[model samples]
Target: ERSGASMAQPETTRVFLNNVDSYASRHIAQVTFEACTDSVKAAALISDVEAELVSNHKRTFQVVGTVSHPSAVERPHRLDRDELLSKLMGCDVVIYNVTQHADQVEEALWAASALHSEVEHFSGPKMFILISTIMTWACSKPADPDDLELPFTDAIFWSRRAHPNFERHIDLEKRVVKMGKTVSLQLFSTYVVAAGLQYGMGEQIFHYFFKKSWLGEDGPVFGDGENIVPTIHIHDLASVVCSVIQHQPRPYYLLAVDDSNNTMEEIVKKIASVLGPGKIQKKPSEDAFLTKDLTDSLLVSLRMEAAYIKKLFSFNWVCQFGLVENIEVVVQEYRQSRGLLPVRLCVLGPPAVGKTTVSKKICEYYRLHHVTVKGTVSDTIARLVSSLLSPPNQSELSTLNRNMNPAGLEEELLLNVMRDELMTHPCKNQGYVLEDFPQTREQAKELFDGKEEDLSCVATEFVLCLEATEAFLLDRVLNLPESRVQEHNCEPENFSRRLAAYNEKQSEDDVVLNYFYEHDIIPLQFGNPNAEADCLPLMQKVIDMVGQPRNYGPSSQEVKEEERRKAGERLRREAQERAEVEQMEADEARARAARWAEWTKKLEQVRQQEEEELEATSRPMRGYLMEQVVPTLSQGLTACCRAQPQDPVDFLAEYLLKNNPFEA
Candidate 1:
């Protein structure tokens, strides 16, 4: 009679096996095994047993006693024989599931013997139950007469052969049977069949096969079409174990239950069918089964049958689903658990084209990270310059001096330094955004070599070009603060001059406009303000276009036309300025010529008058003596010698040479 039960029904037995833990309890307990750790069959069995125990039988069993050899990695140590006997001395039933090592089984038997002998005062009808696997008896057929060694002595032989310690288990059973108490030993031959291949489930046959696929041309496979594989669903296995524990069966009964008794080929075929055609591979006949080599200590045939304990606790056969169905369920569950979902994106144009603003809006709408690639050559250079120049210390002087020539430093050195810094910076991983690298064609080519082969290697998702009128650029440059102007080395007064030089040096092909359309470095052209109304729709179209891979050739006619238009605009402005300057110079030359002509005429008139005066004085006084004539001649000579108004034309030419030497 069981405690806390209806006394009227004496045949109805309620066995209270408290804390009867073992390998079954640790694995086949309520908790599910991790996918990576155990076979699918093992997991299914454990899960099934746990479910039945929780739903049908409200039996709370904790691990009480587990006898394991010091090296047994499978059994728990906290529930040793001493602890088990102490807890079960007063208990009515002792349900023992002996599936571990032989030494453990021997220890349990010794503990039981001690409990029975030492505790004479306690009178309890203790029933000992032993569950064993048929694997402990099955042996492989001998090879040749010469190879007549003990069948189970070799590692390869023991792998397929039954356990050599089966006699010890049977001997223990006989001893218990002789103890004057009822003893039942259930010899079970059950096989655990995993439900399906899953991700991260502890080691399994599928993983073993997949890993083998990487080894060589062909992977390992099981041999012999005759070996029949019997599998039991984990849940059913647990149910059967629980059933045997609750209602004690007849003593010394071999319970042979096979869920599905199919050959290895049939099982492989079923797995292949679920996984799809051509999934299962056959092994070569030469080395069909793995053999052991002591010198190398290698197991030739990697495939091994499922452990014996799993085979003994098999349940009734249930309609098994193919791998596809199981995989679909697992995939769905994994996806849901990981929160992996589809993404919606809206990519803006190239650098400096309001892509950041648009990206922020898109991210806000989609609730995603708005990642922007910062650090253009210019920005990097500016930063480097800032660091070097900020304190105005010795280091700053050294850096500048290192790059500087005796005359001056070139801008290219600073740009190179900036490029190096940018290349070294970490890549942005979040969502899409603008990057300001690759400002030039050469830089782009350097940064993204073999872009024609693969675009993903490049740092940017898409390339965009921001277009603006030269006038607009000039205005922007001119209005910048003194510090900014100095930083870029741009002077407002020299704006037109520098622009002309820049345009002359810059190539139309060098510019990256509509970077997306072009395969090399896609360029996108955007108007001023880069308004969303205009740009968003274009961006959407570009996004759709970029979905497919493309091989864009050199710059198109449209790009050339746009560049030509800009060049024409610059030429027109320059032509107009040149014409105005020419007109001003012509007016100044005419005015200077008129003034010189007036001065020349006046000088000539003055000289004529002086000559007449001199003639009149030399005309020899009609009267007066020789002395007066000589004196008059002296006066005429003095008057002639006096500088008679230097020639104004010559004077003016000389004056211009001394004062305005460059004036032609």
Candidate 2:
């Protein structure tokens, strides 16, 4: 509560981080260490607290219990109150992290009460930071624009699974603030999944739906996905927790969420694009339990305003991994989980260059499926025209025969081809190589500008631009085989016309080229189009950029078995150490008792002798004084009287004042 006074000081503060076992809490604990103390907690199997932040975490953080583990009940449920109290006694700060439920605050506070001391009058500079969710905001209302900065005295007890036990959290937060003015109670509200390489709630649910849909068991389900879901990266959330830990902000219910301005439908489409595309079936919202909590929150149109936190701590996700980017992470993870490589690329260049050749080489080198947009478009036109001519399905043919633009058909085909290739073996091994696509400005704009709704997860890591001179282009076009010319309909005159059109359309400020360059897809122009050149070096360069996709899959049995083996080792080692410590302490206690007994016996003997000596000396001295010294002194004093026996008072005074110097 008293952190305000010492906020500027660097303290070797002990922070009691609760819920450290959780996925999110571990991040907070890791980042909080740099800002707090560096002293290790002495790594032990029984110690729930980490001795150090080794990378992210070194072990599973279980609840450290005072009582021994007995499988009779849940072995690791409660903390040993006295043992925990001892640790709490040393801590200067307590970070009360709560998730899952608001009633968790009570358990945390109860644990913290062990740190309290009435006699100490702990009006603490000691702080207790309550890092809770906005779902914990207990007001009967959804959000309080007016009193966003204030506390709610009264609140509703009941809420959806999305926000349950909110009233208790509110009660706890208010009580904590009232109890400790300087303590922080930050309530963060996030609507959607926190971004990362995660496969927890929403991601796993999405994966299930994707698997079902892909297997034709079920379709991707969302009820008209226009719900606005606030999103934030896990890293950003971790950073926010660190900021609060480092600079304890003024205690308030600070609502922090990413301002990803995408509707729920857009996010799902992005997910679907990666998983595999199919028509999404409308599912009832009420059917949503865990799976639909994602969209249900959005359906509520609930969003957290990050303005408050931003004003205070400049809350921002530097990665800027927004809705689609997060979806990309989950998609990549999904693919990797299935022993599939996740990679997407596109090669764009002008007419009559080695674009197709270089792409084919790269695809062959990597065992990837090489896709040519022109060929796919041609095939698509053929198929669609054939469908239109044949009236097998009269209704389907009627829809196909509608007045559709050639350009639109080409664009649709391009997307379809890319999607189809990505879903198949093109992405099975090393991923696909897209070539001779995005020729026109519109196509480039549609693919690269993040505008096309149909195109999802079409991020290109590299754009290989094979440059050729006008003479080389003309030569390649004009010298084409008769059969090649007849097949494609690009004759010598057609080549000149195509070259002219390309030159006219292609300018230094070409939108397509600029788009790639702006997105860090700057063209790797490496070709002597005037003459044939080896493209191995260029292909290698592209490979270097793409890097190697991790071949590891998630949750292998071997890995889990290894972890179990390590846990067993740790447990045995810890048990041995505990036994050693107990034995050592017992030995020391016995040694101390023996030494105390020996010292006590020796001291008692010495004391008795001293008493005997004192009594013996006193008897001799009394006898000497009474018998010899007193009689001799009386005679000497009588002989040496100062006054000549004249006056009694004078004689007494003279005797008392007389120095025996003359007589001695």
Candidate 3:
């Protein structure tokens, strides 16, 4: 009868998980909300709990998440204190996590204080749970002083002490419990869950070590590396949060850690072996790249176990055996979460078949490097020549100086150079597009030979062959512009010779096609006469043949950074354009003003010259009038007045006639 009812019906439980903005809180909220839902796969760590709990009641979560830094503009996820309180009042179970951020400890205490103050006017039985960290017990004294290896468990949680740096967390935990005791008369209760160091989904505290290992660097270990750092997968930690929300166990303090007691050295070595070149370097505690809090957490020597969870909960163990034991799944999560996989490709084609063009397009679209013979040969020879300057290769330098043609070196040396280029960091990380390489079957074999069971890291995922008919190739060469013809050596005679060489069939045993066929890799043949006319369709076909990308696109953080960069570029361009226009306008106005000023000065000089000329011509006439005309007219008039007779008129006329200035 009990079994029948367990499978008979389903119910819903509204749960509130706060601080969803944090790394730990986000995982807990996601697991609690999605534990029994049909939309998402129930967390693997809580499969047993899911089977038991979903059989009776389903859970729905009201998650409150906020950004770490406050924004000037309002955001939907950034809730205020009143808004947070309102969300808290509506849910049956409220979970506030103080594990990730120190500030969250204050938030948890505030929630508890608010609950205690409002317990008298309660609506329903509300349980307030605080998710904390095992670091709080980093300095705890073991119950048995004689047994130094005694493991700390939740049964002895009362005797646990905090590290000197984590007193604030311990104080907050105590206050939360005190507040819960004050609300005993009402339907209110509190629980403090101390979780182990979390690892998974790219990680938080262990991210520095994970990234260094992934980059194939020497993983750094602090101090002697013998400290036992207890760890739990974030999924498992979330499962513990789910279990607490559902069961509401009797204990107020619960220790959440895995079964494994692996030391720091064991964990670092395991990570390096799985992802890196299996190298580790020990450094002083002060040399670690992690923040002070994380460094302290990483160097912690406390050993802890989830004794209460093991005895009371029925969840399946996801990394409950611990991180080093389940390194593969954790490493996969790390790679996929960060999008750090490479997608290598090789392109093959006859001359004038658009091999370089298509390879460049593919590299641009996929964020890959275009590796070609010309570039690789030049770079490799340059590096070899540069290396010759060192004392270790002095003999090689002398030999190279004697021979100008480094390209004439043995085939083995060239092959090694190409192999080295293929193994470069960019090719291993972002990926590479090899263009027109391995022309012969023997060359392909030498470059790509790998072990019997495993492929080399530089092996190509796909091979593309571009082909065209002889008639099409001939016509295309004829239609090429003079510059293009000269640049590619595609004149009629040269083009025909190259085409014939490309078409000549190889012996059955020595064909390059046979090499690929034997390896079960069929070359994708793409032949389109109009491919050069429009390249998008060809690119699309190639993309379809390749299928989904092996590596992920830009991450969210990268996208935001790119957006900011584009915005800055646009603003800079606009400012430059505005400045140019303003300068041009200023120059035009100055030019016009200068021209007007010059014209006005020239007009003033012309007017002054005309005035001076007029004065010089009129000055002689004025002097003659004053010196001759006035005296002559005065003598004539005096004679006429004295005569006063008929002959006087004739006398005055004779006197004036003889009185001309020049004649006198």
Q: Which structure among the candidates has the greatest lDDT?
A: 3
Give the residue spans of candidate 3 off by over 4 A: 1-10, 36-75, 80-83, 120-123, 142-147, 178-186, 222-224, 281-283, 289-295, 351-430, 434-464, 468-605, 612-620, 629-664
- Model 2 RMSD to the real structure? 32.0
By lDDT, highest first, what's the ranking?
3, 2, 1
Model 3 C-alpha lDDT per residue in residues 76-132, reported as the tens digit of each score: 655778987887777667787777778777777887888778776666767788887
lDDT of 3: 0.74
Ranking by TM-score: 3, 2, 1
Off by over 4 Å in 2: 1-4, 8-11, 33-78, 101-103, 112-124, 137-165, 182-224, 290-299, 319-664
- Candidate 2 global CA lDDT score: 0.52
The Cα local distance difference test for each model comes to 0.41, 0.52, 0.74
Give the lowest summed-lDDT range of ten residues in model 2.
Answer: 187-196
Each candidate's number of clashing pairs is: 30, 2, 0
Q: Between the candidate structures 1 and 3, which one is better when assessed by TM-score? A: 3
Q: Give the least accurate 10-residue stretch of model 1, judged by summed lDDT.
A: 293-302
Per-model RMSD to reference: 32.6, 32.0, 9.5
Alpha-carbon deviation at 22 in model 2, angstroms: 2.4
Q: List the candidates' TM-scores in order.
A: 0.32, 0.42, 0.66
Model with the higher TM-score, candidate 1 or 2: 2
